[model samples]
Target: MYTREETIRRMNGLGRAGAPFFFVISHDLEHNLLFERKDGGQGRSAAFSLPLGERGGLRDCPPLPEQIRFDPVPCPLSRYAAAFSSVRAHLLRGDSYLLNLCVATPVKTNLTLPHLFRFARAPYRMLLGPDASVSGVHGRACACFSPEPFVRVRGREIATFPMKGTADAATPEARRWLEEDEKENRESATIVDLMRNDLSMVASRVRVKRYRYISPVETRGGTILQCSSEICGALPENWPSRLGEIMMALLPAGSVTGAPKEATCRAIAEAEDMERGFYTGIFGFFNGRDLDSAVAIRFMEEDGANLVYKSGGGITVMSRMEEEYREAIAKVYVPFDL
Candidate 1:
């Protein structure tokens, strides 16, 4: 565990020395962990599928259970409505243009975090905390399987893919609908604009490479459509030296926190009961030259005897309470194969 400044200094050193390492930073930027890529994760925690490379020398991927049992009990409707109401009130009051509201729902699953990580179908995944396994059940505590890429840096170019809207794939014309919906479009466009500005702070010639692109995400429960856009910028020649500083400039991710990042985050604290912890935080792997990372959505954590899945969606002035609540609940499912 390292303080923010200490973490930055260490990352600066690693990047400057062209050392490959994995890192996890908490949502509030309070706790940071860095693992050298040499020796296949000497640190207590293990991470793999880091977008840029794989974490080697891990236990073999286990086969899925014959009968995988997973059931998530959504947050109570009244409670979600109250939270939604609070966020809506903020939107109406014009304190912020958009605010992301989230909730923690209790989930029952036969599998543990490590096994869950193995079965996760996400592009980016991480497993951390105390040692745990099926028979041991000591509880590892934190597990993340994210489909959203926070940002990727290759050479002197930096790019970000911000996922905004989600729709039930079972719905007819969901792809077209998500692409055309006013609220969803507004949310995606706002995040895209916000990210462009974020990148512009550290890079030059920022631009939108793609807008409102749709991708399908499959989970054990069902498939859903995700809307995203790609934004790019040109990094300085010495970006490797300032890698940590660049990341520090663009964090707590705009997709999860919403526009006018600082104020919206404060409003989020007032609306959502549970602290986001590392759930929406950004994690990345710096492999000497290039960097890749993901926003910690599609995430879960262990709470005592209970397994809590934290999820949520963006809220804007056009957002409807019922739909937003439904979206949050829909996001609670595990990103596992059907």
Candidate 2:
């Protein structure tokens, strides 16, 4: 658990030496830890699973035990409505165009962090160490198996895949509907614009290379189709040496936070009223040359003797309370095969 200043310094030093390492930062810009590569990407506090190839492949993970199990308690609609109302008020007052609202729902799962680390079918996954109290990691046992990538850098080219707006893939013409729906389009467009602006802060010739691309997410509950876009920018030739400054400028990721990032974060605090911990933070690996990272969504943590999964959706002036509540709840399933 290093301070931001220390984390930046450590990251920059690694960059200068071209050392491969792993890093994680929380939503509040508070807790950040950078672990230099030790024994082929084994940090003292965590084991990593990342997709480094064209396909979502990863290092060897343990085989699953039989009887995969997962069941999440539904969050009361009333609680979600209250939070939605709070955020919507901010929107109505012109505080922000979009604000992402998240919630913690206790899930009944006969699975452990190790089990998830082994079997959860996600490209970017992590299992926090020896125990939760291990400092930089969450204070409770936790693991994140996130489908959304925050950023990727190769040579002088850096790109972000901003995921927003989800539709039930089970529905007829869902992909077409997600692309055509005004609200969903607006949400995805806002995030794409925000990410483009963020990248321009440290790069040149930023542009949206892809818009409203569809990616299907499979869960134990069902299939969810998500909309995302690719925004790319040209970084300096020495970008690796200044990786810390670049990362600090581009995160906690516009897709998770929202447009007008600063104010929206404050609005999120007032509405969420609880620490996000690492749920929406960014974590990544720098493989000495190229880098890749994932937004810390699709997250779960151990709470005392129980397991809690954190999930949420973006809210806009055009958002509906009932629909948004259902979206948040629908995001709660573990990434498991039937």
Candidate 3:
């Protein structure tokens, strides 16, 4: 178990807190990786481009056999809703600043840690070398390993894209669904606005660089569409010193926590009925100069004899109980056919 102090030290040690910005690191397996921005310290760290001939280090570890499989275990949404509501009420009352709410779905899987890691995919198609690991119960399952998001920081331009909603888009109009889904659009807009406001805390000229954008991500299950918004702002020349503090102002990520950020986070915490741990925490490599990180989502963890996939969506006053409940469970999939 990682203590809060230990986690904080490691996070700060990665140089994400302060100036030489130019590296990428995953917070943990099954999490997102953070990349330094292009203008990162005058290109001291260039974007990590995969070599055309460079195949990821998947060969070092062969893929899992076809016969490998396991039964499924599920958790109830009413329990999670109750937990979310509890936290929501407290946050609404102004008891906490920001809270990261999470729920664990105990599941069974036959694949080993490495096998599961190889199954997930993203926009960057990470050059998976040996930098992967998993944690979970022995006979149950493991949290698929992953790093953080790819971030680019330059001068006063700080931008972030947080992925929020997910849906099975087997239809030819896959892009249409991502763009038109009412729930998805509503959730994305809330987060985009929240992030813009967050940047305003440390930056000027805050704006939405991009609106509801669709990124076609290839997962193990085929292709799952994810919607995101890009928000940016101009920081002061002395931003390096205050980078950590600025980020802290945007804790638990707006995407995971509904608008009226504080209130929503509390509700999520109480409704989920479980601690999020590092699930939705931001992670990545940042060396003072500029920092880039990804909101930890689409994550799984090891808990006793079961592999718990932690997932949820943003909730608003307009959110229906049944829809929100289904949304939370809908995120539990591995995004692959296996």
Candidate 4:
């Protein structure tokens, strides 16, 4: 684990030298891994890459395996309800306007970590740790198949795409509902405002380029419509040399953490009663001149004797416990190109 200061210095130096690198910063900003592109030794740090379309030079991944099955047992409705109540109380008390609460659901699967990654289809994917070398079916590994970009920079332009709303796409009016729902619109707008503020700290001329837009995401359970917004800003001169500092300013991804960040994060910890570890974290690559990264959502970590899928959504004063609980459970599916 590198100290935040040390991580910043090292990233700045690498950025100045124009060296290609990849980094994963945990949600709490306590643990981080940074590796040079040429480093072949996997020490707690394995393969981390942006979605194929975003990576300029990385080779495309091989085809997925024939078939795989994943079975997940979500957190009890009562438990999620309790967490939701806590967040709602906080909202009522003016402690936070919005909070992103999450839970880990224990999953049973017939495939190992590598096989799971090979079969999973996502816009952004990452595999961390030494699980691939182990012959047994059981091991400690964390895989992130995410769709939201935490931030991306090319030249002097930086952009963040914050995803906030979700609905079952199979429903007849899913896309229309997601786009027109007052609650969902409020949720996405809040995060977009937070992200715009975050960017303004290290950037100039921050603006919301796009408002709430609906996109279809494919998952094993079926298609789900997600609402997202694009916010972009102009980085100050010599921005690349301050890459670490800039990232530090926007971390834990506003989309996942919530508005009024510090207080909301505290409430999240107190209500959830578990460390998020790397889930909801940030991972991406800086290929010499450009950077592309994603929020570590749609994540699964291998715990002893079980795999845990971590997922959640935003909570507000208008949020319903049952609706939030259902959203959490619905996010547990893995995407495959069936």
Candidate 5:
């Protein structure tokens, strides 16, 4: 693992840019080491792409309000099947419990691809610019974001949203509907419990301020429903110094991974066929007093000359393979709104 100092130095080397670049924090199972990389200077070469264009919706589209065009390159299913069986065996042996198994789907689209337009239109949505890229590895596309704390410094306050569940959101009340959904509830609880433990590690006191809160994001794939639980705690005066450690303690965000973190991570190593690269790492910027970062999801990496978007959902013992398969496919998008 790159030392906290090393990670910060890399960021500083990028100079002042539009935003802090993408970062990937990955632990190699075989090597048992952590890796960090700044996005390097690849942002200048990066050509953004989105599915939505001048064309309003695709012609002859479904009536579903959340429906959108999704196209991905064909990938071999045999590979994913083998990996799933391996993970299932581990679960059966009790080596690991819940794991988020994933695979990459190389994609191509005939529809309009949004690049310069995204920055021109929605500036906040643009994560990285000229210096935007993963932190540890060079010349790689990765997704990373801040944890989005709801508290500010100089006070005795803290809040974190432990995002956990996902569902289809094609309805007008997508957020409200998902808030009461059972499947989402169970998943959010597991991660909320995990986050509470995480906060307790470095917090003076912790509390579950809210439970089963919902957020909806419109993507090219459709309206993805996400459920999160808010937890708060009291931090020490020296909390800023240990912020890196606190974030590291929550490595491989529980929401993206699964419950019983360690074992589940092991299962991911055994079950996941392709290298995750920077898919689930966290990245953000801190100006000393406060820090912000994001769990690297909604990410795309290049496989040779082709771009492959990586996405998947957490799996429990209750997870169905068919449903999981659909979720994996549903994640590929160019960040287009339906």
Candidate 6:
């Protein structure tokens, strides 16, 4: 584990030198992975950025063979419902305004980690470790196919897109329901407010650039509509020199952690009863000037011989246990090209 000061110094030095690098910051900010971009760096650390609708840099990484089958086995509804009830009870008692409750579902697949990496469909995807393994300090191998951006920095502008609502587009009324859903609207607004406050810490002129935009994501199960909002801010003149400090102030992304962050996170720990490790963490690349990153959702990690998929949704006082449980399970499928 690296000290906060050490992490700050390293990132600032690298950013100031105009060196290219990649970093993985965990949910709790207790564990971090940093690697220089040359020769893929050293040890069990690997990082790459693949934009949506493009497969250019993946020449060396071949796609999965057609013969390989993929099957995901999500957690049983009874168990998930029990956890959902616990979170709702906390909400009823005024413990937290909202919480992003998550669970790990075991998946059965014939393909390996490298094969999954080559075929996973998402705008922001990353795999870390040697031999395409995800095993790091925690001795677990994992990969992320996330559609949520933790933050992005370009010159003096900093922006973040917080995604909160989801619905199966196969339903004829999906669009209308998502746009009209009072619960989803409130959840998105809370996160947007939280993100605006976060940006105000090191940035000036923070504002919500976009609100309640629907983005359609095609997955193997079906097309799912996601609700997101864009928030932007202007950074200080010496932002690059304080990259580490800036990130620390906005850590554990507000969308995943919920409003009134600290208390919500504590409640999540008590409710989850499991280690998040790198599941909801943030990973991205820095080219000395511009930086891009994503929240580590839609994640799968290797635990011994089995693969576990981690997925979750936002919970509020208005949340229903049955719907929340279904949303968590519905997110377990991979978004393969259809």
Q: Rank by lDDT, highest first.
A: 1, 2, 6, 4, 5, 3
Clashes of 5: 18
Could you tell which candidate, 1 or 6, scores higher by lDDT? 1
* Candidate of highest TM-score: 1
Q: What is the TM-score of each candidate against the true structure?
A: 0.94, 0.93, 0.69, 0.92, 0.71, 0.93
Clashes of each: 0, 0, 48, 0, 18, 3
lDDT of 3 by residue, 110-203 (tens): 6544455455553222222222321221222333332224234666688777666666566687688778877667667766777777778868
Residue 159, candidate 3: how far off, in angstroms? 0.5
Error of 4 at 328 (Å): 0.3
Pairs that collide, model 2: none
Cand. 3 TM to true fold: 0.69
lDDT of each: 0.83, 0.82, 0.53, 0.81, 0.53, 0.81
Candidate 4 local accuracy as lDDT? 0.81
**Residues 211-283, model 5: lDDT tens digits:** 8766666654566676767888887765654554555555666766776888888789777767775566554
Q: lDDT by residue for model 4 over 1-338, one digit each (tens)?
A: 56678888888999889888888788888677777777655443365546423322223545454655578798778888888888888999988989999999988776655544555777677777553441112335788788888898988999999999999988998888887888888888889889999999999999999998778888878889888999999998788799999998898789998989999998999899567877888888888888889999988888876778889999999988888888888999888777
Q: What is the lDDT of residue 202 in candidate 4?
A: 91
Instruction: Tell how far residue 325 is off in model 3, in angstroms.
Output: 3.4
Global Cα lDDT for candidate 1: 0.83
Q: What would the TM-score be for candidate 2 when compared with the true structure? A: 0.93
Per-residue CA lDDT of candidate 6, range 1-338, in tens? 45556778888888778887777788888777766766342543454564422222445766666765667787777888877888888888887888999998888887666655667777787776544433544778777889888888888999999998999999999999989999999999899999999999989999999999999998877899999999999998888888888998998898998978988888888889568988898888887778888998988888888888888999999988888988988998787764
Cα deviation of 12, candidate 3, in Å:
7.7
Give the per-residue lDDT of model 1 (tens digit) for 196-237: 999999999999999989899887777899988999999999
